[model samples]
Target: MLGMPVTSFGWSVNLIVYLIEEFNIKSIAAAQITNIVNGCLSMLPVVAAILANSFFGNTPVISVSALISLLGIVLLTLISFFDNLRPRPCETGSILCNSPSKLQFGILCAALALVTTGSAGTRVTLASAGANQYEKRKDQGSFFNWYVLTVNIGAIISATAIVYTQDNVSWKLGFGLCAAANLISAIVFISGKRFYKHEKPMGSPFTSLLCVLVASMVKRKAVISSKEEDYHNRGIGKEAKPSVSMPSKSFRFLNRAALKTEGDKKPDVDSIKNIWSLCSVQEVEDCKSVLQLLPLSLAIIFVTTPIVTQSSFMVLQALVTDRGLGPHFKVPAASVQVISIISSCIFIIMNNWIVYPLYHKLTHKPLTPLQKVGIGHVFIVVSMAVSAVVEAKRLRTVENEDHMSVLWLFLPLVVVGIGEAFQSPANTDFFYGEFPESLRNTATSLISLVFGISFYLSTALIDLIQRTTKWLPDDINHGRVDNVYWVLVIVGVLNFGYFLACSWLYRYRNLQGDNEQDPKDIIT
Candidate 1:
């Protein structure tokens, strides 16, 4: 529901402009309010994620959020239907010209925020929860691949369907359809709960890992070398003092004293073995290994953020492009996302069917997650460079009073989608492989946090540039968006360099193999 409205809003920017012209209202003021609504809504995912991790868990959170989103969609539909009854000038015949009272608009904003909060929670929790189910099964690798595939399926469907609805009907219908879809998803989820594995909130895994590492450090420090002398000692060996031996007594008396009582049997061999293992120095090193890697994993999140912006920002760019296919047919601007979706599907097929198998056959090495991530970065950089060229062409086109072909935009989008298909799946695999079982959910959340923060940062940068730059024109088509594209180019290049650094750093580090014993299992 939230995504559909957001997509529609991007398409309807021109519609908002038309509303201003028709209603003779302060356009900038309305635009500001809308921007605030969008930004605040975007933050819903973070809040939802926290709630899923801390309190409600996935099922209840997703269910409740879907219902709330449905209500919000209903409200929007009502607002649309009642447009003619509201007081407003109608010069351009825009839907928003049916100027509902400021109070009505405020209510709409409130409802949208409510929808956002619910959608955000659902988005954050659902995928992880699905993945968690796979962990209970032994052959989880294939399950996870399917999980990622399913997400893409939903995204592809939503992008196409919502855009089609908005173009063919109205924004209200598009949003209402999304709300209905979410409600159905909620019902299906509830029905399937018994078939799935449920997860309990384990208090922050990062904290737990840190605690174990600190304890290990303390234990290591407390160990005193038997060979080292104390400050008071000058030449004496610490544990080599000579002692006189005189004992010659029989042990029969001690054997009588050591006879077992009713409660005492042979000592449990397994328990003694466990205690011995826990006290070993190797165990301490294992804990330290986990501690050392977590921060590094956190660092990877920042690098992963830009990959996602392909979908978010690309959708925004498509809105301003002219998309007439022929004399009587015009593609909806938002429908350009279908290119990315199709490209992603193709990429997945090529990788799974050809690329990975060919690589394994030629090199006799299974594809490593880091290697996959590195490859993903290469694609992302290429995509960004392609985008920069397109933007530059667009700039030139504007200067010469010529329109650039929409196909130019499609090329970069396709490249970026392929990059995402590689990066997202590899990133998910990396998290699962790198983190211990106890910390899987938390690790997943950290991944989500990286994505969330990246989007927040990207938007902030976009808004900052738009507000600060005198080069940008007040009109949409006439603006210096090329500069923004160039900035994205720089960011993408930096991301590629960062990934290379990470790959080099990771190569020297010892990673645990899939069959390696967990520290907790080894100790206990």
Candidate 2:
């Protein structure tokens, strides 16, 4: 939920800035409204996560979030309608005049934020949660691959169609379309409840642990009581004699010798009795089993962050590049995302169909999640290098007063998309596979939290660059975004190197085996 909004917010924030400049709104007011909207909207995932883990359970939580998203879509459409209906102050010789009440603008911003909260918070998280309903870890990987594919599909279609419609037709139509799409998504999710695993919320983990401990203690006590009863029935009462109350002389001597060798203090009778109890067996093993994956999960999060930069910094760079298709036509700035979508689709097809088959045939070895992630890092490095080259070419073109074709930018997008396909699916697979069944949703949320943090970091980096550099000077094409692209290239290279080091360190680490029941039968 959080990560999707981070991507959507990137576009929406830029869109808000564009509206402010185009409509001559006060910059302070515009920024305030955008920030308010983003702040509220960003909280949805946390809300969804809480609700899913507390009361609603995964299915109901997902359904509610989807419905909320649909409402948000409708609200955005309303905002666009109102904007269109308002009289143009520019045409009335009041270009600098305040027309729409600031209160009205504030209300609209609030509504936008509300819509985002539902769409971002509920919809995104639920979709991922739904994917976890899969039975086997291998199936979980397949499910996540499809989940990532669906998201890119949405981005691709939205970028191509929404950007074109907003630019050429009407912003109202563009927003209305998204709203309608949300409604459709809501319906689809609601219908799928019967097919999803119906695991109820487990409540607080601390409380659950306490309950388990208490239950084990009770079981231990019951067993000890039964043993005492058995001894009494056998007429071996404690008052009868010390030897009668205990065991054979040889056994007593062995026990005394063992206790003496371990410590000088005599072992307690209750402690010895408790040693024969079986209640602690499962509990201790369970705790150890879950703890085994902590290091692996942390490592996965570290590697996952750089891939997330694609939607943030990379999209921002694409907006500034010269994309004139011909003399009369210019490429829609947001449509550049379609290149990644196409590239991702192609890579997915090729990886499943040709690449994996060829590798299996040649080596007679199946690809492991770690190996896949390692390959993904290699592609990430290559993608960044390709981006650097593209940026370098663009820089030269801008300096020489020459026009570069929009087709040139496609090269980098394609490279990045291929890299994304290589890494994202593999990363998702690795995280899901290594986690225990009980922690699936929590584990997924943790992965998403890392992604969210990465995006915030990227956004902060961009803002810092803008503030510190002369890149955004008043007359420099509204702040030379080219510098931003260069910065991304440098960051991407560093991320690639970091991931390589981590992958190397993790090469010999053992992954947790899959133990969860398959989701298929549970759902059916």
Estimate candidate 2's alpha-carbon lDDT, on a 0 to 1 scale.
Answer: 0.53
**Which is the leading candidate under lDDT?**
1
Sequence-dependent TM-score of model 1 = 0.72
> lDDT tens digits, residues 416-496, model 1?
778767876767666655655544544455555566556556556655776788534444456655566667667767666
Residue pairs in collision within model 2: 44-121, 135-518, 135-519, 472-479
Q: How well is each residue in 1-524 modelled by candidate 2, as lDDT tens digits? A: 32343235324534543345334454334433444344344435656665676666777766666666666656656766775523244545554654555766565555566566665565345545756566666667777777777666666666776767776777777776666666666676677677766866655433333433443444432322212212211212564222222222221212221112211223343353333232122223333334444554544444444444444434445545666776887776557667877798778778877887797789665466656666665665566566667666766776788655667767767876887787767766665554434445554555555555555554455457657886644233345444555565566566555555544444221243442322211100
- Which residue window of length 10 is worst by lDDT in model 2? 515-524
In angstroms, the error of model 1 at 462 is: 1.9
TM agreement with the true structure for every prediction: 0.72, 0.70
